[model samples]
Target: MPTPIQRVSERIAFAARTAFDRLPPEMVVSAFGVQYGHLSTAEGGDLFVTRLGWPMLDRLLPSQWYADGWYASHGSQLKGSTGNVYRVASRPAGGKSLDLVVKFSRMAQEVPLEVSTGFPDNVPPEVIANARFNSPMEEFGLVMELRGGGAAPELPRMLTQKPLAIYVPPETYQLWELGRSRSRFENHGHMLSRDQEHATKAIELDIRRMYVLVYGWIKGLDAEDAAEDAGLDAADLERLTVEVIAEMHERGFRVLDNKPKHFIVRPLRRGGGLLHREGALVYGLVDYELLQRTTEHQEAFWSRRRQIYRDLFRRRDEPSPASSATHLRPGRVFGVDYLYAETPDGGRVWTVGRNPGLFDYFLASRWHRTPRTKLSPRNEVYATRTRDGIDIVYRKSNVGVRPRADPFERRGRQIREHGYNSPFETVAIAEALRRKGIAATVPLAITRTGHHSGTARFLHDARRFRVHEPFRTPGAPAEPILIPDFDYYTLWASFGCSGQEAGATVDLETARARELLDDAEFKALAGQSRADLVALGIAGVPIANHEFLLSTDAAGRLERDARGKTRVALAMDALTAFEYQVLKEDRYQDLLRRISGQLGTLGVQKLDFSGNDVLVLLGLDGEFLAGPDGEISGTLCSFELMRGFEGLIGEPPEGVPGI
Candidate 1:
């Protein structure tokens, strides 16, 4: 008779098979774990089903499609490190045939554990933690990314199912106990006693639970088998292996194990032939457990590609000086490394990082070909789909322009008086604000139009734009280093929302505020909340409708927090507001009075009240309430005009007090 553990495993498997049969044909599932009595399986460890495999599961496992069907016949075991694999064959509903591979990650075996001690020879603690946490999910995620065409078409498709089914047996508890003990032993080598061999054997047998993975059977022979059958020499096999590895690197992946068995070679149409008609044999890789993108590969390939594109753009824009050697590379500025490139129009593109997805999307020719919406005479904006199918907005920076009769001309004057930050400075400020927990628009890249006068014009005068800063090397006294001016264009990101789009975001001034309050209604609010409004002004920030954005769900209703208040984040253009003024001077003075007593409490000395600088977080009932800190909770988005009180010491220079 079968043991109790075996009976329980069989029962769980039967329940899963029954559930799979009832699933609708259109429903697709991915990345689900199984839960049993006092036990839970990890993602990709239990079961995974992909979109393509959803309609075909029943056809793929006819015998196991129903409760009355015979149990699946397990075939010869295949080799694997973390799991055991077996060939599974079954007949379809109408006498069709199927061939599949089923992988079983049995819990009986002790998983290898890595414990870091901060020693030089050991792996870093973070790396070990990441490996432990990501091992189960990495393979599925990588395979999905590859299948989505994020990389080359040289990888296998994943047919994973969702909500992995759990299997609980009498031995499940024992398996857990053994696995934990073995992990402890492996992590702490000194814990092993003199009878290490007996302990190892005891740990091995206690493994019980198992995860199942199913994939469509590929019709091919292993590289070794193909080589032997085709009578290929060792040199030929080695050459093929090297070529495969090179292709993988080009596609942004590195295989941790490069064994010949990991590769499969399909036979040609002509029975005996192994090569394709084009004289090149195509092969696919299997076993994605150790597949990952390395930092070295990213820098060497993607980053280098970005540099090439940048150089090409620069070269097309203007001719390089015969005497000056131009090497396309990343330049360090303000503690940030920017990837430098020149555009075809003699413009310059300085990306914020070595390899940002934004650069790859915006710099592409397709984006340039897309029609642009002119928001202003000086600001041209474009919306296009990135490679990942995300909507992103790109607007030209309006630096170096002087506009007359502008409604906010006073604010413009203040900005000019304080010194206009270059595109680089803008990006730096955006990053700094984000670090301080202030919501703001994410800055992707900076593009500067070509010097109208030509590169030679700046050759002699470039030093004038360069700022001298103190720099000391070794024991020498501080010296000034000249930093040249590389004119920049506007920054870009997914607009009207945070960098990562979760849901729809609406402009506070035009869309949301109007929907929530009528002109007269807002006027009433101005009267009722005058004190609170003034308090906001005194907080040393401006309030603007366009500077803030409210997040909403798909239904267009505002998202709420636990306390039933509307949620908001700073918009990308929020920082562009540099002047301070409320719509009325009386309101501004009232705000100044409200915050005067707490002037030292506020991080900055001066307060700027414009119609657009901050967000007044609102409750569902439309009532304003103090945030957690007993002050009106406002989302301060801009730091452009905010300045420190010279008299204060040992305090942060920005943000609302107690925020």
Candidate 2:
């Protein structure tokens, strides 16, 4: 409805806004509410550009390359489906102009369910929908794998790929009416001829959206065209095609569409034959819409890779004296031993890098000799001494509980989806958090428990558990282990000052109130601790009073600052707490809403803070400077049940799971 000039002005403004940010902003707001404005196709579908792609594009193109300034002069349309392709001729600063192919993928594909399932009948509609939903990401994965040292099979080098943005057009009754009318009229003739049941579910169509990808343009012609120009016979072309297919499979990929057009062959030089001087033909494959590896293949490849990695680690570390033991195997590093044991009920145990003597003592007589503290109905905490005389805690992981009614049911469900983590996961997360400057208990070793004939029902999940293949014993059969239990060093050992003496530690709440009352500023904000607790409660986070432990020097008095003022303890029991006598009236919903909003602002989601999940550090003034916005500024000690956020590794390489 707007004039041409107005439309141009609008587009210019959009380009300016989007170009200002190096990577496109995730969302934008308009009269139609918030929408994804970045990384969309020319026809307004979803598109994604990867992190690696961004730097390459920036280096090769001008700053205004994404804007109308460069695009207007150098961008030309290329043939594609689901969305448009643009060949942008970009001239780098003082460099030659180069052509880059930018592909905008229609996010959804409507392939017949029959093709996906290989079944003519009884296919579920949801299967087709799910396939369409994952198609875009699947293609991205393939490109990423090739980029990350996977066999490329002479494919065009992918410069980078990323999700640009999601475009959801404003819903309108008119659009819905148009869709319904078209659906009915277009299928009318076919419906009249076919049976009602057959016609109803005859086709599966998805017109949802698209994503974007960028690749360095390959200089070549399609195999079909190149063969004709090069005077190659049908048999010669077929031989070349067969070679290409064999190479793709060798690299752990199976291309569903092996058409001649998808293969590109570079033109021979003048006076050169169709074949290279070395008698080899150079070609590349394209159009990876139906590319994937079978589940069995994936497991086998990863398992082999893991074994090679372990072998390398073993070779790198010096052989321990314990390696001489017949039943024991040398671990990946020195001072570590992999101890194997059989339970009384005929179950198996694989303990990682723990003292063999300590393992024997603990696993002896079904752990009956070890004393335990009942932390909760589901958790039993126990302590044991290693052969080296260092104490460690063994907490039983209650992985398979199906509670019918509980306040934490939602959180429990989320954790289950990621799998009930074993000691391996615990150690991996702890090490990762420590690297990120977050304080957490150290994981010493993992004990995998297998089910015996008389295993209890409560231990079913653990008994039937499969060890992460990477950590499994090499050459062992791929079988499920019993539940995995983790061992952790004591928290008090983390304290800097000498606090081993009795009565040298107190809860953080008591220490702060007792020591910081003299300072007016500290006294004024003393209620902040209570306020934080209220916020956490409103946010549906449950914590125990005993979790926060504060440690003092051997003098049994609060540590003093250089100015002689009392200093806060490092080992705090509770980050924040309130005295029962001064409890305030509950503002349940308001507090919950406020806490939820604050957590959302901090990008914390699907996280459970129950018990000792979070640790807060306090400054000399007795205040935790979590920032002016009261965002959570603390160490996340526990990662169990945390989801929807990046872990210490950030994004893993393609096909690799996060540790």
Candidate 3:
């Protein structure tokens, strides 16, 4: 450790440097097989590398190393957090000149939990062929294809089809400032234990730093609002915000995170300026890993409400209700209908949401909605019970953020045992899965519960009941739909744990699933599950000696092809992080074994889990109706399998099955 005076000097120097850059490099943090050094370079002064693991560096750098000068190689070191962030640099193999920025993250894991060194067996070939909440999607079996240097207009089109962009968030910025403040406090407080002044001073400085932008943002927008009337103007803003939200939601995308860091206020034109005051300013949102096809509106509303209260009210015990969406209905804004979609090539389309009106509306609604709270300061009330039958209220903070007084106390964050959604863990797992011959498509989207409220069981119920095959359908084939009495595949995925803390295969007990099930939607779905399963032929029988840990809840989403056939599209959404780890470990494999054993007992010697590893699997019921064509199971080949599949068939793979 540096001496007291030296430390103080270092702190001062660090602060001066960081005043300009996003990351300040004055300290060294060592972990894994590497070490990182932070300092300012002449290029873009104030920028710093917060952390860099050696093995990671060695893998990233073009050469062994160089001095404080810049180079010309393209490289980066990712912290592997939920932020798909990377401290990037471009250096020539033997030249000068470098460019650096903290790149964003679309996916992250806790390093060790899910290690995907390579592919598994032939996995699915689709974008989300076979996915797992804990394991990587078995679609990345294909090598990553990078696209750059293309004309600007094509960028958006290509991006949506097959592009991944990362971003930094305001929280990271806040955390860094928090650390700086804490350091300042500790330095002064070390000698003057009762020096509240020192701590307050540091905190005040940080608060000012963090909020200057918020205040300016609000003030600037308020000025804009002054030009319009509340009735029509407010309605217009609300409609714009909701419309933009609807477009993004329908496309199935989520922004970088909760803040302005990953986004920008840019001109609508290609030649935009910095002031954001000129023509066609819009929210140029960045980052993709956080994107999701399905996110509840309430979560987003609550998040915005929390920010409004924290920033606008400054924790002054103000009961502001306007900070959040007054609307209760879930629709377009809640789901990004305008931002993402699947392409003909099965890639992705992500640029649909980057428009001017969208950003303007986003800022307007977020800045102005500061409603008054109903409760008294230091008072508490019972949490809400939703119509979906979910009573999963865990947070205590009634502030816009938690809607309660404190979240830690009620202990609602059950699955959050490690990394705030580990991006590192997933990276490794995805890599490993690829090595194992699986085609794992990574997440462009992530889900958030009310506490992460998922209607998983309901989705299951809906799907299972949609095509329930009662025992005696007059002309049904010998093996119809999913036979409940003898054999059935528990098509599901895992959620919660991380690669760093738990292996990808950690198992979550029912207690935890119970916690996840606390979600209103799942609870209501569970209410209908028993009757549906009974109708489907599994109410009393032992198919594969297995009782569904996830008894299907009926919300009826399973879709059969429009063709006059039994062919259908099934999405198996199962497993929380805990369950994924369990499967990654002994139990999941064991569960597979138990199921297989039960199948043997049923005199069925054949089985097919032969594809890539996944949180869930999609299969067409071919046992009777042509028993899933080759495209069903054969349609999926993990990265490992995809490559090898071609060699085996001496030809490229096929496409979607049936209608």
**Against the true structure, whose TM-score is highest?**
1
Residue-level lDDT of model 1, residues 1-659, one tens digit each, is: 98665764554454345444454322222221111111112211222344445445444333342113222344455654345555555455556645666554332243354433422222335544444212232344555554443344445332222211222222254545434445533332321121122111111112344334455666687677787667677787777767766666556665554556767787665556475535667576766655666544443333333334433333332323343323233554444456565444445566666553334444533244343444333235555433223334565433333222234677555544443333444455555555555444555666554444233432233321332133211122322222333344444444453243334554343332325545664344334343444443424344444334556777656766797544544432211212222223554343334443333353542234433434343322323334465654333333334444322222212331311
Candidate 3: regions farther than 4 A off: 1-5, 12-219, 229-238, 244-536, 540-562, 566-659
lDDT of 3 by residue, 99-177 (tens): 3333221121221223132322122233233221111111110101111211111223212212111111122254443
Cα lDDT for residue 133, candidate 1: 16
Best by lDDT: 1
Error of 2 at 55 (Å): 4.5
Question: What's the residue-level lDDT of 52 in candidate 1?
Answer: 44
Model 1 regions lying over 4 Å from their true place: 1-48, 60-74, 79-82, 106-137, 152-173, 176-209, 268-273, 296-659
Worst 10 residues of 3 by lDDT: 211-220
lDDT of each: 0.42, 0.41, 0.25
RMSD of each: 27.1, 27.9, 26.5
Query: Could you tell me the C-alpha RMSD of candidate 1 in Å?
Result: 27.1
Compared with the true structure, model 3 gives a TM-score of 0.22
